[model samples]
Target chain A: MQRLIVWSLAGLILVPAAWAGGDKKNGNDKVFKIEGTLAKDDPADKLRKNPHKVHEYKMKAGANYVIDMITKNAQELDPYLRLEDSAGKNLAEDDDGGGFPNARIIFKAPKDDTYRIIATAFKGVGDYTLTVRVASEAQSILEQLKESLGTKQKELFKQFPAAKTEEARQKITDRFYELTADSLLPLSEFAQKYADDPAAKEAKNMVRNNLRQLEQSDSPGVGKVLRTLREKGPKEMHGQVSLALSQNLRSQYERSYQRKDKDAGKLLKEIEDLLKHVGENHADLASQVKDVQFTLKNLTVGRPAMEIEAEDLDTKTFKLSDYRGKVVVIDFWGHW
Target chain B: MYPHERSLVKRLENSPFALIGVNSDQDREKLKKTLEDEKITWRSFWNGPKGTGGPISAAWHVQSWPTIYVLDGDGVIRYRNVRGEAMDRAVDELLKELEAKKK
Candidate 1:
């Protein structure tokens, strides 16, 4: 035969280009660029040292990658990113996106093999610069802008309860802040032009955490589109959008001090002017706004009950002023 | 919450009400097997194993998670975060204002 049919069509095109050149010479899907330095003896540095720098790759299935880390000591680390896979589940995670304290993860490989990437430090640590790329057309424009922003957020939540009026709910809250800034300003200009693509900083921090949960709605046009995205958003998400607008103005000052709502001291001076724009380097949100100003001055509702000793399961010690005359009802609870 | 405070502690077992619990569960045999499988006849307390800064939800500034208050018989706090049946109508209007201040 003609030389064994040209050597069986060159052994079926050299066996898939010698199995894709032996997975590009054994570096599986390649493109890593790791660099580390967390410290305090690595392994999740005990107590509060926060350290967890792991990395591994392989991936392939449908390709696309993007995992970035970066960190030029943004006020002592603070980065955090997680991926996991080889059975350890969790597929993606990030904190402070690549702003403030860097971390990113723009995945795709739903199958093919190994994954794991950890890199931690939500407080402080040091050096970093992870990076991984592959990025197929910025992961098909972030899966077509996350399937057209989940079909325009389910058609703006079905036109938000038929906008019954307040000028048709402020024109459906200005068309939900113009469909969340036309679906996150083109994924924040494709993550500032692939700023070392951690899936375009995870699709621009998932469109700024879904526009900070629609600016924690209490509606007036989502509080005037969160006061115009706190005067034009993205300064590394102004301290997580002013700590979610000071926890939605301390849950509307505890629902206007539990319905005695004559705007309870104007919602406690608008929660002390949103905890003075939450600054004092957020000492745990200024000790949770000084424990909500000591539970609005000693646990509200006509204050007074503040004692509580605790210890019963037969281990004695009681008190809450030992149920004085009686009509107590404390609760507090938890068995799980 | 423990079946509406175990049926308002058996409908205020003979009045002058009390129901104080606190608990935080750092596993004292799983809070004594959930206060003996939830029969929980009042008297609780515990709040340790560092939950909410232990020592009684950091001395009363408990910022939510089952925080329920309601004191009255001169103790003071009059209904903090009422619940089910508005916490049985604020303990039947503070046990009818401590039975009209004991006559």
Candidate 2:
């Protein structure tokens, strides 16, 4: 059973890489699967508190379909979610983005058509699993993803040779853990890939010794920027300030989890306060702050639902719930 | 991705794609300067009490900077995790489907 489980896990990781290479459709477009999980299994490791994702799928016209999504917990914080067809019109939509730990948003697919799924987390921490399956459409993206992964893996080995040095090897191996240490099997598989390599073995030991360090590793290069903010305030590099702030908090949270510190709660509070403080003054940054807060709230354990109220530029007053019947996608963001 | 994600902001200013920007520069004057200098024409939404991120940030569940979601007319969620070429392709693809369905 253990070996079986290991094989299955290996398949999951290798499959995606395979599809990245061959298995191109008629259009030669790359395919990907929706299986597996994006968050840590412990539940404590998630800090999603923002709304920002646009999922799109193409389908044959006039087909019956359903979009399946899994939310880890239950909440009443409904965001606006919608589905629009290729012609720039809504086929089906709702005002609530919540109500989905594993939800199916059903719709009728027009002939030879494609659709986009739009949703905003109007209130709460966001740890969600989204899956789309249009049974009637002959084209299943999930199946395609699986097929693609099979082919891509072979190509990866062909083009990408093994790391040449301990430093170079450590980079890939370190990156793997730094990005996915919370993932038990992923960490294990990547380690096994280079089991024979001495550098890989050393790197794996380092990763094991500091597995928990993954959480603290959010700041790849922002440590200096974060310290600068602490000492000098937001006077310089204001644009990067927000990014550094998020990274700083992420690293701090990781550290707290590692040390089992008594100041965990206080640190979290300070981070929130700092975010709020940043939002209070930076009108443009305020949205970014809110979004980060929302993500933290959603993916955090034992958290309250978020409540958001916004005025649509065209409408008089728009409460997130008001768009309940339609799919509402709130882009509570802008780019620099 | 490599351009706005790779090249420089100046390149983005000259691209043909339409952009709706949210400036994070603390200084309004600086923000305005960047926009004017770059020849930006899209709408700008300032982060406010009800802006995208805030205590309400938890409300939207925004995990990172520069997030976007699309909804149907009745406000059902349709798509997410989009940016760069994926966003443009997805939007164009959806619009095409919507038009065909209507016809």
User: Which candidate gets the maximum lDDT versus the true structure?
Assistant: 1
Look at candidate 2 and tell me the lDDT of residue A285.
67
Q: Model 1, residue A181: displacement in angstroms? A: 19
Those runs of model 1 whose alpha carbons end farther than 4 Å from true positions after fitting are A1-228, A234-247, A251-263, A268-336, B1-17, B20-103
Quote the true-contact fraction of every model.
Answer: 0.90, 0.30
lDDT of 2 by residue, A107-196 (tens): 656566556665434344455555554343222332233234435544444533576764565455434433332232232344455455
Listed in order, the DockQ scores are 0.34, 0.12
lDDT of 1 at A72: 67
Candidate 1 residue lDDT tens string, A158-271: 987987755686576656655664565467667777778556767777876866665444344444445556567555555555555554555455556555667667756765
The parts of candidate 2 lying over 4 Å away from their true place are A1-336, B1-29, B49-58, B72-74
Taking all chains together, each candidate's TM-score versus the true structure is: 0.27, 0.27
- TM-score of A-chain in each prediction? 0.28, 0.26
Q: Which number leads on DockQ? A: 1
